[model samples]
Target chain A: MRIALLGGTGDVGEGLALRWGYHSSHDVVVGSRDPDDAHAAADEYEATLDAHGRDAKFTGFENAMAADRADVVVLAVPPYHVADTVEAVADRLDAGDIIVTPAAGLTRDDEGFHYHPPSAGSVTALVADAAPDGVPVVGAFHSLAAGRLADLDADLDVDTLLLADDESAKDTVAGLTEDIDGLRALDAGGLANAAEVESLTPLLINVAQRNDDLWDLGVRFQ
Target chain B: MRIALLGGTGDVGEGLALRWGYHSSHDVVVGSRDPDDAHAAADEYEATLDAHGRDAKFTGFENAMAADRADVVVLAVPPYHVADTVEAVADRLDAGDIIVTPAAGLTRDDEGFHYHPPSAGSVTALVADAAPDGVPVVGAFHSLAAGRLADLDADLDVDTLLLADDESAKDTVAGLTEDIDGLRALDAGGLANAAEVESLTPLLINVAQRNDDLWDLGVRFQ
Candidate 1:
């Protein structure tokens, strides 16, 4: 499968690129507004995989071009950029393709991080609204820490909740998630439950901030 | 410290009463609308502790009476009953008392469970509004599985997110949470973040429903 990481120069996108490139045979494409920046990130990801003695298929392209060539497009962009990013790639997406969002609307104050969901209810819901008709949108990986995910030496026995209105799209995303070795994907119903899944990111952040030993905390269900 | 479990006949309330009764030296009071029901629940909890060969302080009382004596009162009622339960005990709470709510507003359909947060933002926020002046309301244990919590043999290396504007009250609750073996409390900002914490419950339920060998799941941070 071809997986395109939109905003591939960013923290989350870079993490996903390296993990998918190193752990599986899937084609990993890095996407950015600037093609040069996307190529730079893809080179870095390639070097990291090389250090681990893994050779895999990897490429870089502008966001639209990357989406056009991929089976799954991951909107690994920041919360503020998700809607615009979807709009930029909408024309390339079709019925068989899927868009997965890991973005969560968040704000911080003197107290701590809080889930500041968009008017559409959640970032996933916002992405669903912006997606081209018949192209399914699934929400996953919202609670995983990018730093932990990027660290190849880190053993991730973590759970990533999946939510989507389309059952086949959700199953496809779940299968892709489990390809990363220790990551377990659990079905969390439909997109109506996306707010609950997105909100977990801030709670995990706050927990990591307060505990001395729990930096870059990710969730496990037992 | 005297810890009162209001609506003590219910699942969450019974779970808390048994855990506190067995794990800590603090007084555990089971409170219900009916004193007889509370006492019956208390007896059942005592028998469970006796089987484990731990003798502890345990009692039963009406909800109002329980609140009158407790340093910390846990509103273990369902989401719909939280407001009226808080109203019933308001006169009993004073400046030094603290109220903790674990209620999450949820509605289940054919698909799965979805978070149905109240207009007051969250059940914890509603409790905060209904609480007596100077009596702080802290949200904790919102994500814990009652079945897992109540099972003494279940090893819970789980995290409970605490949210409250009152730092001292949060500290007090954190201390109480640590009294239960294997449970760690992490501060999750203030009451404004309550919706995020409460919403986790429904997501957990949905996940547990869909996955095998994941029944009565609880969360751990790594």
Candidate 2:
């Protein structure tokens, strides 16, 4: 499959590109607002894979260009940037293409952290609203740790909750999600249940904060 | 130090209880809404420690009683129950007692998961508001995964973010967080930053959902 990591200069985007390039046969492209940065990241990633004895084809381009050439486009930006990022690439997205978002808005206070949804309900909804008509926007990957993902040597066994209204789009994303070894993809109903799933991140972080033994903690549903 | 897991039947509660009981001299107590459940969980934890030849003292009680007896009380409950849980156990809590909350409110929609804060802003703030006056409320453990924690055999080399208005309480929670092996505690500023920390959960979950090969995902700052 042709996959594009929009905002591919970021920690999560870089991690995704490395993994897809090294672990799968899919074509991986790095996208950034600055094409130069994207190309530079692609070079670094390719070198890292080369050092590890994997010869994978990785390309770089502007965000819109990356989205235009791919079957799947992942918005790997921060929660605050989700809508703007999608809007910037909206024209490049096609009818059959899938767009996925994993951003969650949050707030903090004297005691600890909590989710802060946009007035539109969730960050994912914001992205979907910003996308051009006819494109499928799927909500997913809202609970992954960037550092853990960037570590290509690490073996992961974890579960990801999937939420989307478009069944076909969700299934396509689900198929993509489970393709990686040791990762489990679960259907967490639909987009309406997204808040419940997204909220778990802060809970997990808080648990890791108080406990002594867990750090960079990941969840695996029994 | 005396530690109490107020909802010890849950994954995060059990994990914290087991780790402290097995790895330290701190007195570990299992607390639940139902004292019987606490007793059962305590018994199992004790047996696990005993099999490993660790001489750690563990006990069980209702959450209120547990809070009354411990220097530290972990309100390890779901997001929706945080305030009520703290309120329910408020009277038993003393001035020097430290109360910690790891819950994050989030909402979902057609796109993906996003953080959902209560009307008061962050869940942590709500906890402090609900807590008795003078009883220090510290927000910690907002991002660790339960499956990684419950497994005694897992290797955790991750960082826990801490936020609080009380420096002493934050320091205390930080000390407790790093008591276990392979964990680092980071000062992610004060309560003002709790929203940023807590909001990362749903974003991580969303990333896990959309990506292939990530599960039980965690975060580690570079």
Candidate 3:
């Protein structure tokens, strides 16, 4: 399957790009507002994979072009940019194609980081509202530690919770998620539960901050 | 410290009573609206500890009586009853006493459970508002798997995020939490972060419902 990482020049996008490039045979493409930046990120990710002795189908393009070529498109941008990113690629998304959102809105204060969701209830919901009809929007990877995900040396024996109304699209995304050896995906019910799933990101960050030894903490459900 | 589990006849209350009785030297007390029920639960908890050959300080009383006798009083009732429970025992609370709330408001439908926080933002915050000044309110254990907590055979190799504006009270609760084997307590900042922490409970329940092999799931941050 082909996968596009929109806003793939950023932190979380970089993590997903490198992980897919290393672990799966899928064609991984980086998408950015600036195609040059996307191309540069794709090259950097490909070089990292090459160092690990894996030559994979990794490339980059403008957001819409990437969406056009991909079966699954990930809006890996920050929370504020999620809707605009989806709108930018709206015309390119075809029926049966899946749009996955991993972004969560958060605001930081002197005390700590708090889950600051958008008016639509969550970033995933915001993306859902902006995307064209017939395209399934799945919420996953909302609470992943991007730094840990990018580090191939890290085992990532953690789980990612998934939320979507469409079963087929959810399953398709879940399959892609497990292609990376150590990560497991569990169904967390429908799109209405997006707020709860997205909030876990900031909660995890707060927990990680107060604990001295833990940085870039990922969650495991036991 | 004398720890009172208000509404000790319930699922979460029973779990906490048993765990504290078996794991810590703190005097564990069961409090219910009906004193008879409290006494019965206390007897049952003591019986469980006796079966395992451990002698511990365990007892029960009416809600106000329990609050009067204890340094830390846990409002272990359901979300809707939290404020009233506090009001019922308001006069019994003394200065420097602490009230802990493990409750989160949730609504369920065909899909699964959703976090239905009170207008005050979170159950913890509501409890804080209802609580009299000088008696600190700390939020912890909002996401514990009750059945696993009640079962002594199960190892609680998990973390509980704590929220409180009172640093000393938070420290006290953290110390009490670590007394239970395999449970780690991480500071999740002040009570403002309570909504995010509270939402995790329903999210976990939703995930557990969809995944057959797992039920009563607890989170561990890695």
Candidate 4:
């Protein structure tokens, strides 16, 4: 399957692009508002994977073009950009295609990061609301450590909680998740549970900030 | 230090009663709305400890009486009853004493459990609002699996995220959390982060429900 990571110049997008390019044969595409920036990121990702002695399958284009080329489009953009990105690429998304969002809304204060859900309840719901009809929107990878995920040498033995109203779409995303070695995907139920799952990112970030010995924190359930 | 578990006959409350009795030398007390119910739970907890070849320091009383007996009072009650429970025990609590709440507001439907935090933002915030001025309210243990926490034979290698406005009181609760075998405490900053920490409960529940092999799931950050 082809994957178009909208806002692929960012931290999370770069990480997912590298991981998929290194581990699987899927064609990974980078999407940005500026096609030139997307192209540069794609070249850099390819170089990084090549340096690790792995075959790289990566491409770059504008958001709409990238979305049109892939069956799975990951909205790897910031929380504030989720809705706009979905709308920008809505026309390019085909029926039965999935849009995945790892964006978690948070507000930082003197104390630390706090979960700040959108008026629609969660970032995923916001994406689902803006997405075109028949295009499934799924919430995933909301709690991954992007820096660690981008590093090929870093060992990832963590679980990613998945949420969506569509079971088939959820399973497809889960399959992509498990395709990357060491990442496990566990279904956390429908979009209603999105806030609960998305809120975990800030908690993980807070714990990681306070605990010096622990870095790039990832969660596991046992 | 003496510790009291208000609403100690319930799932989470009873689990705390058993764990503290079996693991630490601190005197553990059970508190209930009905004194008779508290007494029965205390006796049962002592018997369980005795059967495990452990000496038990367990007692029972009404909520107000229990609060008066301890420097640390844990409001291990349901989310809806938090403020009322605090009000009922307020007169018995002394200045500088700590109140710990593991309550998380959640509403369940056909889709599963969704976080239903109060208008105050989180259950911990609601608790802090109801608690007396000089008394500190700290949030802990909201994400624990009570059935696993109650079982002495189950090996618990998990982390608990703590939130509090008072640094000294937070340290005190951290010490108690560390007292339990295999339980590590990580400070998650001030009470503002409570919603993120408390919201983890429903996420764990939803994941546990979907994954058959996983039960009584506890989080470990790696």
Candidate 1 lDDT (Cα, whole model)?
0.90
Query: lDDT score, residue B11, model 4?
Result: 91
TM-score of chain B of each: 0.98, 0.94, 0.98, 0.99
Tens-place lDDT digits, model 3, residues A1-222: 999999988889889888988888888989999999988888888889888898875788999999999999999888898888888889999999999999999999887888899999888889889988899999999878999989988888989999999999999999999998888999998999999999999888898888889988888999
The parts of candidate 4 lying over 4 Å away from their true place are none
Name the weakest run of 10 consecutive residues (lDDT summed) in model 4 chain A. Answer: A54-63
Q: Put the candidates in DockQ order, highest first.
A: 4, 3, 1, 2
Superposition error at B27 for model 2 (Å): 1.4
Selected candidate, larger DockQ, 1 vs 4: 4
TM-score-wise, the better of 1 and 2 is 1
- Docking quality level of the chain pair in candidate 2: incorrect
- Assess each model's interface with DockQ, reporting 2 decimals per model: 0.77, 0.09, 0.84, 0.86
How does candidate 2 score on lDDT?
Answer: 0.78
List runs of model 1 lying over 4 Å from the truth.
none
Q: Which stretches of candidate 2 lie over 4 Å from their true place?
A: A1-94, A98-118, A138-222, B9-11, B33-41, B78-81, B105-117, B195-219
Task: Give me the candidate number with maximum lDDT.
Answer: 4
Q: What CAPRI grade goes to candidate 3?
A: high
Write model 3 residue lDDT over B114-211, tens digit each, in one string. 99999999999999999998999999998799999999999999999899999999999999999999899988889999999999889989999999
Q: For every candidate, how close is chain A to the native chain A in TM-score?
A: 0.98, 0.94, 0.98, 0.99
Q: Kindly list the per-residue Cα lDDT of model 1 for residues B2-116, writing each as its tens digit.
A: 9999998899987888788878888989999999998898888998889989886578899999999899999999899999999998899889799999999999888788888
Could you give candidate 4's per-residue lDDT for residues A135-193 as a string of tens digits? 99899998899999999899999999999999999999999999999999999999988
Off by over 4 Å in 3: none
Error of 2 at B168 (Å): 1.9
- Indicate the residue-level lDDT of A90 in model 4: 90
